[model samples]
Each structure stands twice: as C-alpha cells, then as structure tokens.
Target: MIDICEESLKLQEQLVAWRRELHRCPEVGLETPLTAAFISKKLTDLQIEHQTNVGGSGIVGIIRGGKKGQTIALRADMDALAIREDTGLSFASQNGNMHACGHDAHAAMLLGAAGILCTRRDQLRGNIKLIFQSGEEGPGGAKPMIEEGVLEDPCVDSVMGLHIGNQFHEVKNGQVGLHYGNVMACLDSFKIKITGRGCHGAMPNMGVDPIVIAAQVITALQTLVSREIVPTSPAVVTVGIVNGGVAYNIIPDEVVLIGTARALEQGVRDQLAGRIENLVAGIAQGMRGGYEFSYTYGYPPLVNNEEFTKGFKKTAEKIVGAKNVIEIAKPTMGGEDMAYYLEKVPGTFFFLGSGNPEKNADYPHHNARFDIDEDVLWKGTALLAQGAIDWLENNGGPA
Candidate 1:
C-alpha cells in the first residue's frame, strides 16, 4: 500500500534472475537441498530470521516488524516434477526435473516479497513467515513441516498460499482467484489384483481368466461414479494402469489394476472406495477369480477457511485492483498438498494467473511445453507481500 508498486517493479528484474537460476536446477520432492540452500542464503542476506531442514528440505523465513502486532504466513512450494524439459529456452531445466507446476515462480516471488518486507520493516505491523515447502508433488511435505512446528513458536494467526492457473481468461493479468470452500479434490490411490488359474489360450473353459475378470471389474468401477454416486456431487474413479499377461499362447494367472479416486466430498471419497472394494470382490468371486483391492488416501480436499478467505479477498482487491480479483465458481478435481496445512490451521489457498497468449505461456500445467509469463512474476511477488502486510495489520495479533 505504501507505493510498494514501484518496489515491485524494481524487484521484477531480481525475480527473473532468481526464477531462471531455479529453473535451470529443478529438484523433485523432498530432495530440494539446492533449492532450500538458495532460499536460506537469500533470506540470510536480507537479515531475515529463518529455520531450515523443516519437514525435509522445507524452510521457514520469519521477518519481525518494528511493532508488535499479528503473525501472518505466506507460503510457496519448492518441489519440481519428474518431467523432462522441452521448452527449448536457454534457462530451461538442466536436470531431469521441471517446474511444470510453476513452483519456481512461487519461490522467486516469495524471495522478492522478502526483499520488499525487509526494506520496509518499519512499516510492518507484525511478523511474516515465508514457508518454502518441498514435496508438493506427492508424499506430502506440508504435514511434516507442520509436525516440525512450522506453525508454532510464533503461532501463526492466519496463512495464505497461491497457485498458478492457465484457465479462465476473464481473470487474467495475474488476478487472484479464490473459492470459498472445497477448492480441490481429495485423492486416493488404489490397486486391485485378481488371481486365477493359468491355462492354454487355445483352450476354452479349462481355467479362470484373470484378464477377463479384470476387464469386468474395470467396467463395474466406472459405474460407481456415473450410476451409484450422486450426480450433483463430483467424483472420479479411473483405472489408469493395468498389468497382466505374459504371452499370447498362455492365459495369465493374475492381473493387477492401478488407479485413483478423486472427490470433493469426504463421504463421496469413502463411498467410492468402499464400493470399489466390494464390487471388485463380488465380481471376482462370481467369476471364479479371487481379487484383492488396496487403497491409500492421499491429500484431503482443500477447504478454504472462510474467515481467512474474507481477509484474502479484501487484500487481493487492494493489491491487484478490485477488477482483477475473481471468485471461481467450480472447484478443480486436482489436489494440492497445501490441504495438509489448511487441515492444521485456518488458511486460504488461491490461484494466480500465469497465462499470457501473447507470450505463448498458455499451456496447462505438467505439459512439456509449459512456461510462465515471466512478466507476471513481479505482480505475484507484490501480491504476496501486500497480502501478508494487510492480514497482519488488520488482524492485529497472533491470537
């Protein structure tokens, strides 16, 4: 609010550099040693207090203002995916990992915010915690960080995070996109194995065919969403990978199916899981093949806290202009590990548009051609800085 706009513009150049450096050396999951070291070095240089090795390569930077007030947290994920780069840019990923999810931009923008906040510490009303988390891609890094006391000592009053989105052009120009509740789906992975007797392929009725039984199970599982689950409630049960059979002449003795289920409602998730197990077991038994199913629940659906969301809405309107702030009507089936953080503390996670057709940055996330509009980097940096400051000043205390 204090003409941080100009500061943001100046920091744009710095952010570009930071982003390129990170882009060239992308790391995956909890093994972001280099990424964490870079962030720590920058925070240290800015005289910001921080902690390291939190929840495996997670780092937290604390900036205490001159006055006593509230504690607000701004988070950014630092993990990259196991994607090979094909963007053909000079600064494209040298390692096998790529920032297809735009986490590189998240880290750089937060570092930029750190710079602005450090320079204007006197104007700050409270404490700001910058969370550089790793392993957002899977095996969730957020829970471990929270367990390591990332949310304590200072005890954050409220927290916020932003993800980059390519859809919905009406809210372009790095606008903040917020949803009141159930912003992302809960993910659960499952594997089903069918056991049967092997026999010659040319023989008929000589043995049980696991492949045929597995196919029947697949068709039945699809019915869970289209027929069994409520139409109004969203849910997906996809059989992504199926493994069986060794030779054309011999019928395979067993078949294994792997897939995931996604749902916005907790009941839907549980119902689908139960239905899958029961249906698969019943079908396998009826077909003279024994089947077993195993499911592991992934991240829970991201439910944005309404109290924190109200603050974030106001903050977004002020920082990026009111016209740029938009409310997303429908939630995405995609899941975020940030749900782990929100589960422990009240927080809001929104989207920052990185799409710019003019710059050819229109590809969706995880695509080999994916790239962000570098120009929006400053806007993101400013938004995070302004949001943290606004939340602390308005809330007035950690409690």
Candidate 2:
C-alpha cells in the first residue's frame, strides 16, 4: 500500500489553504456558481478531467488509472447552510451563510485526495470518480446528479463518502466512525394546512378552531413514534413550525404546521406518514374544519453495504490505526442526501472526528458556532485516497 499518510501530510498546508478560501465565501442551495467554478479550477490545475454544470452546479472529475479495473467513486458536498457565521475565525464567511456542517472541509479533503490520487494514477488499479455535489442541506443535489448520469459513462462499481465533525459526540477526535447498516435515517417532510372560520376571542364557540385542531394533530403525531411504532425501531415526528393566530383578540382563518419525519426502516417511515395523514384528516373532520396534508419524500435511508463497509473499515484502520476506527453501535436519525447515491450503488458513508476540546472546535452540526478541527483535514484526505486505492487493488472489479 502507498504511504497515504505521508502524502497527505505533505499537502496539509495546501489543504488548509483551500479549505479557508472556500470558507470565506459560503454558498447555499443548488445555485452555487462560485463554488463550482472554484472546484473546477482546482481540478483543472491538477490536470484532472471533469464535467461541469452537472445537475445544477455539481461537478464530476474522472481520473483514469494506468491499469484497467472497475471504477470507484468518492463524493463530497459543496454547499453551505443558510445560517450566519459565528466561528469568529479570520477566514469565516461574511456573506451571511456558514459551513456549519463541515462541507468546506469535505470539499477541501476531496480535492486534496484528488491531487494525491492524480499523482499516483499510474499506481492505481482502477479509475476514481470525484463527485463534488451541491445542495446537500436543502432540496437535495444527489437525486438530480444521478438523473444527469454522474454514475454512468465510466460506470461506477462502488462508492464512498465522508462527513467531518462531532455529529455523533460518542466518537472522539482522530477516529473514523462506521456502521454496517442504516448509518443514517430516511427523511420525509410534511406540511399541514387547517382551515376554520375566524372568530373573536370574546365568543366561546362561535367558530371552528383550526389552531386547536393543529395542536391536537401535533401532539398526536408524537404518539405515532412513541406508541405506534415498535419501541426497538427508531422514528421521529417533530412539528418545527406552527403559524395560526395573527392577533391576540382574533383567531386566524387558517393554521399551517410544517415539520419533518424520520425513521431508520422503510416500513416505519411509511407507517408514520400513513398514520399522520389519517389522524390529521380525522381530527379536522371532527372539529368541523377542512385540512390539507402534503408529505414529500426526501432522501431514503443511508444503508452501508456490508461487504464494502468491511473493506472500508480495514482501509481506514490502516490509515488512522485500528484504535481510532470506531464501529458505531447504532444508526443516527440525522438524514443525509448521500443516501440517494447509495440507493443505486454499493458504498459506505462514514464520519471523521473533527472535534478538539483544546481548540474549542467541538460544536454540533448546523449551529452557527459549529466548526471542525482543521488539523483533521489531511487525515480525511488520506482516508479517501488510500481507501479507494486499497478497494481497487483488492476487489479488482465491480462487486
């Protein structure tokens, strides 16, 4: 095996420079023109061939090896959240958006890995597909990229991706967390609209109260997880936004409730949706109000292929030492759009520990103060490059 650690260490300065540069200007959603241009420029500098404007700002870089073998893919998200930056770093974003989820680190590490893999192309046994995707925090860029045929032409046999941070606080710094199955939960969003006649506060029962029905619906939705679904199975039904009354004296004509549902198993996910619709409809009818419930299926469950995860664990252990490789005991309810890629291909999505108490880089993802330990950036680079090399060398062909 190549000395991935040494190669990655040699490029640590470059990786940090790239990460900070991207951090200064954060973009959100699928329309990431600047982020795409930056990634394209880096790939061009490396002499790596790539396709641009893929799935609305996504980029795909193709690095062919000297020896012929099956193609493997490595992915990184490129979009930031809509949150304002609060890290207070000199390189922190000033555009009102933040890389609170460590996507900047993900992109920089993948670029570092691409550079290393490009230099060692002659030593590689197969091709490496570098996927720089956008819009992971929102409407999702993976499904559209797949529709654009990012996985075709070269035909990717297996894939791998990583996230950086203390998303799961149980894992420590320098550790790589892996799980065999259901690494991340499936995500589905719901919006409930209840309509009722407007009435004055002075009157007791003059009009149907949609706000009261919405409150009941929200409370009942919680029981779907705690009472309806099996205790061993994980499920979540949270009402994040509730809008109803416009004034203290008058009840509004309509109420809107927006929230998300999450589950590890598909059966439970479907059950949650069905029960939610039924309960909302029945409650609205009983309360003499009309309602509309819209459930949109987002990303599916991210299931790590057993065989690929085993191989990835071995490769990670070799790079970061077995002591730093942690096998996660349970799956997280957090949803990842990378699950869309795993749905069609065999791959594993793992997490890299980016928390450092000494450096105060231990904030959770999505928080404005969230930040990753930049020191771990090179380790992620080495992990992806070495993992892909080892998999190509061992598997030789598609699994």
Candidate 3:
C-alpha cells in the first residue's frame, strides 16, 4: 500500500488553498458553472483526462492505472448552500452563499486525493473515477449524473464517498466513522394545500376554517411516526412550513403546509407517505374542506454494502489507525444524495471528523457558522485514495 498519508501531507498547503478558494466563491444547486470550471481547471493542471458539462454541470475525471484491473469511483459534491456566511473567516464567501455543509472541503479533498493518486498511476491496479457532483443540497445532481453515463464506458465496479465535519459529535477529530447498513435515511418532501370557504372571523360558524384543518392535519401527521410506525423502526415527520390566513377579521380560503419525512427502511418510508396523504385528505373532508397533497420522493436510504464497508474500514484503519476508526452505532435520519450512487453500484459512504473545539470548528453541518478543521482535510484525501487503491489490489478486476 502507498504511503497516502505522507503524500497527502506533502500537499496539505495546496489542499488548504483549494478549499479556501472554493469557500470564497460558493455556488448553489445545479447551476454550479464557476465551481465546475474550477474543478475542471484543477484536473487539467493535474494532467488528468476529464469530461465537463455532464448531467448539467457535473464533472468526471478519469485516471487510468498502468496495470489494468477494475474501475472504482470516488465522489464529492461541489454545490454550496443558500445560507449567508457567518463564520467570519478571512476566506468567507462574499456571494451570500456558504459551504456550510463542508462541500468545499469535499471538493478540495477529492482534488488532493486526485493529485496523490494521479502521480502514482503506475502503482495503482485499476482506474479511478473522480466524480465532482453538483446540487447535493436539493434537486439532486447524482441521479442526472448517473443518467449521463458516469458509471459506464469505464464501467465502475465499486464506489466510495465521504463527508466532512462532526455529523456524529461523539467521534473526535481525525476519527473515521463507518457503518455496515442503513447509514443514512431516505428523504421525501410533501406539500399540502387546504381549501375552505372564506368568511368573517367574528362569525366563526360562517367560515369553513382551513387554518384549523391544516393544524389538525399537522397534528395527525405526527401520529404516523409516533403511533402508526413501529417504535423500533426509526421515522420522522416534520411540518416545516405553514402559510395561511389574511387578517384578524377575515379568514383565508386556503392554507398551505410543506414539510419532509425521513425513514431508515423503504417500507416505512412508503408507509409514512401513504399514511400522511390519507390523514390529510381525511382531515380536510371531516372539516368540510378540500385538500391537495403533493409528495416528492428524494434520495433513498444510504445502505452501505457489507463487503465493501468491511474492506473500506480495513483500509481506513491502515491509514488512520485502528484507534481512530469508529464504528457507527446507528443510522442518521439525515438524507444524502450519495445514496443515489450507492443504489446503482456497491459502495460505502463514511464520515471524516473535522471538528476541533479548541479552534471553534465544531459547528453542525448546514449552519451558517459551520466550518471544518482544515488539518483533517488531507486525512480525508489520503483515506479515499488508499481505500480505492486497496480495493483494486484485493478484488483485481470486475467479475
């Protein structure tokens, strides 16, 4: 196995520079032209072959090994969040967007890994596919990229990806978190529009109050998780948005509610959505009103392939030490579009601890103040490169 740690450490300064530059100019969603250009430029500098404008702004860099074997892919999301920067770092984004989810680090680390692996191409046993994806925050970019044939041509046999920051706070800095199955939850968004008769608030009986119906619907949706779902199974139903009413005296004719549901199991996820729609429709009818429910299924639960995860964990232990490898106890309710890629190919998505309370870098992901401990960025790069190299060496070529 290559000394990836040493190679990554040698390029630590370059990694930090790339991360800071990306942090300064953050782009959001599928429209990540600047970010994609930057990544393409880096690949060009590395003398690696890559294709851009894939699946609407996604990029794929192909690094072929001297000794032909199987193909493996390493993915990183390149989009930023819409949140304004509040970290007060010197390199904070000036475009009113932030890399609050450590995507900037993700891109930089992948680049760092690319640099190391590219130079050692002769030593590698198989090809490496570096996937720089856009719009992981929402409106998923992974599905589109896969549609564009990212996994074809070279035909990737296995895949792997990682996230930065303390997703599980229990894991300390420099620690790598790995899980076998159901590492992340499936996500589904729902919108409900309740329609009723508008009338004077003073004459309560004159109006079919949609607000009241919406409130009832929200309360009833909670029961889908607490009552309908088995207690042992994990599920979440949250009504994040509710809009209605016009004035103190006048009742609005319509009320709109939007929220998300998350579940670890596919059955539970589908059941939750079905129950929610039924509850809302039944409640609107009971209140003498009409309702429209729209449910958008997002990413599926990220289940780590047991075989791949075991190999990844062993590779990670080699790079970060056995003591630094932490086994994840349970699955997180949060959703990851990387789940899309894992669904198509055997892969594992792990977390790299980037929190350091001493430097005030322990904020949770998606927060405006969120930032990663820069020192750990290279570790991520090294771990990814090492894992890919090891997998190819062990598995040889695709069966």
Candidate 4:
C-alpha cells in the first residue's frame, strides 16, 4: 500500500485548482483544443510521456512501471455539454459552453492520478495508460481511439474508469456505486421523415396528411417496448424532437421525427432498429404517405465484466470504506461512450456520487446548474490509482 489515500489528500488543492480552471473555460465535442492542450501541459509538468490529437482532440499518456508486469488503462472523458453555465460558482465557464456533466472533475481527477502514479513508477507492477478523451458528448471519441489502437502498443490487460455525479438517486454522497453487469443501456438513435401532400387544415381528406400519419407513428413507436418486448427487460424509446409545419393553418409537406432508443441486451437492441423501420414503413405506406427511415447504432450497452467488477469493488473498498462502496440494484437507461472502451477490453465503469443538498450539487446531469461536491475529488484519484496498482499486481504476470 503506497498511501494513495494520503497522496490523494495532499493533492486535493491541486485537484480543486485543476478542476476549477478547466471548468472556467469549457470546450465541446471533438474539437477540444484548449482542453487537450491543458491536459498535455499537465502531463508534461508531471514529466510523463504522451501523444496528442488521438481520436479527435484526445490525448494518451503512458506510465511504464519499474518491473515486468501487465498493462492497465484508466480513462477520463474531457468534453462538455452545449448547455450554458448557470452554476454560480466563481470559476464557472464564461464561454458559451459548460461542463454540465462533471467532465472537468473527471479530467482533473485522472490528472491527479497521473501525477501520483508517475511518482511511484519504480514501486512495482506494469504500465498504466492515462486516456484523456474528447467528444464523449456527441460523435464518440472512444471508437476512433480504439480504431487508432489506443488499446495496443503495450496492450492493456484490464481497464478502469469512473463517473462523478448524482445521476443515480440511490447512490449517496461520497459513495462508490458498482454494478456487476449491464451497467448502462446502448445509445441508439433513429430518424423518420414522412412525406405527404400539403393541404389546408380544414380538408385533410383532400391530401395525404402527414400530421395524422406522424401522430400514429409516434404513438405506435412507444408500444414497441410496452407490447412487443419482454415485460421484464429494460428498454426505452423516446421521441426527443419532432419537426414539421411552419404555418398554423396548412399541413406540412413532411414531418421529421427523431428519437433515441435504449436497450440493455444485444438481442433486444438488434431487434429495435429493424422493428422501428418496419413499423414506420408499414404505417406510412398504408396511410398513403412516403417515409425515409434511418437507424444509427450508437454506443453499445455498458456491460461490466463481473470478475473485473469484483476486483474493482475491493479496490474501491480499500480506498474508501466498504460501507462507502454501494452496489447498484439495477442498471440505468442512460448511455455512455465509456461503453465503447469496455466493449473492446475487459473493464468496469463505476459511478461516484457527488451529490449533496448542503452544497446544492444535486442538480441533474446536463442541467445548466449542475455541479459536483469538491470534497470527494481526491477519493476518485485514489480509486483510479489504487485500482490500476491492484489489478496490475494481481494480473501483472510473473513479476
């Protein structure tokens, strides 16, 4: 035990500074140039070796250990949402973008872990990959990074990552929430464009009314899970955006329906896309309307390896207390690009509850006013650092 907790505590001020500084000037999507540069500079200051511009604006830093062992990766997402900052903190973003989902804290904590691990490179075990990824909020960064071989070179044996926030209500403040399997749902999206002849509102019968067709399509889309899928399975289909009609009195030529679908199981995930397209095609054709349907398979369901999660649960218990390590009763429908990394490697993604009513940090993720409790920041650093150390020690070959 290298006193990672104490080391993390000592680095608390630095963590707060880095987080708040990153918070002040947030960036968005795949073009996180400033954020990347900041991360690169911090890695450089720690005297760590790294590569830049990986998978969009992502960065990868390598910390080789003193002895012959295996490789483990610790990941951190460094993108912000498009929401404007409303959190009244002094270091809040003045720029148009905001770190509404606590990515700033994630990046800062990984940076803290990087500093700690770099100092202990001669202690024992193998290597650690410090993955500072961009574009987790939109066009995914993990897939491109994997395509570019971030999991290669040294070749990672196990991976570990954590998310900070009160995204799950049962996860109490400062608690580490863990799930054995199916931690999150797949993030899949679909779009449908219904074409009908423009007509006056009073005489919908005179022309093929797209509004009527679209309404039926929307209503029926909901039943895909309620009626078609198994009742016990967790799935969701939500129409977030519906675009049509510019004028009040005339029916539009076309109505575009865009929505997201989430499923925990691959069988169900595969089924949703085909069924949605078929449903739309049938409804539009029977209603005398034409439709264009496109379904995009986004991040796969985040399924944690039960064995790896058991190991990480112990690691988390050591850093915090066993009582502080909470087991999530079930998975959430929320989607995470972290799922992509887990898909390629045997890894686990856990949550850190940073919500506190006293600190007023309980705002929902993606909300403009969302914030995280700064006190538990170091615990995150300790968890990542210790997790890599422990996993590599046990699985790091005949070192």
**Highest TM-score model number:** 4
- Residue pairs with colliding backbones in model 3 are none
Q: List ranges where model 3 is wrong by over 4 Å.
A: none
Count: clashes, candidate 1: 0
lDDT of 3 at 169: 71
Q: How close is candidate 4 to the true structure, as a TM-score?
A: 0.98
lDDT, candidate 1, 1-399, per-residue tens: 457667888888899999999988999988799999999999999999899999999999888888888778889998999999998988998778899988999999989998898887887888888899999997789889998999887888778888875755555757879889897999789999999999999983899999999999999999999999999999988999999999988998999999999999899999987899999989999999998779999999989999889888887887788888899888889889888778877879988888887777988889877899898888888888888878778877443
- Clashing residue pairs in candidate 2 are none
Q: Could you tell me the lDDT of residue 103 within candidate 1?
A: 92
Measured on C-alpha atoms, candidate 4 has an lDDT of 0.93
User: Which runs of model 1 end up more than 4 angstroms from their true locations?
Assistant: 167-170
Q: In terms of TM-score, how similar is model 2 to the real structure?
A: 0.98
Off by over 4 Å in 4: none
Summarize candidate 2's per-residue lDDT along 263-363 as a digit string, tens digits: 99889999988999999999999989999989989999899999999999999998889999999987899999999989899999999998997887977
Off by over 4 Å in 2: 397-399
Quote each prediction's TM-score: 0.96, 0.98, 0.98, 0.98
Error of 4 at 328 (Å): 0.3
| Per-residue lDDT over 1-399 for candidate 3, one digit per residue giving the tens place of the 0 to 100 score | 547888888889999999999999999999899999999999999999999988878999999998879999999999999999999999999999999999999999999999889998997898999999998998899999999999998998999999999999767898999999898999889999999999999897998999999989988888898888999999999999999987988889999999999999999999988888899989999889999989989999999999999999899998889999999898899999999899999989999999998877988889989999999988999998999999999988542
What are the Cα lDDT values of the candidates? 0.88, 0.92, 0.92, 0.93
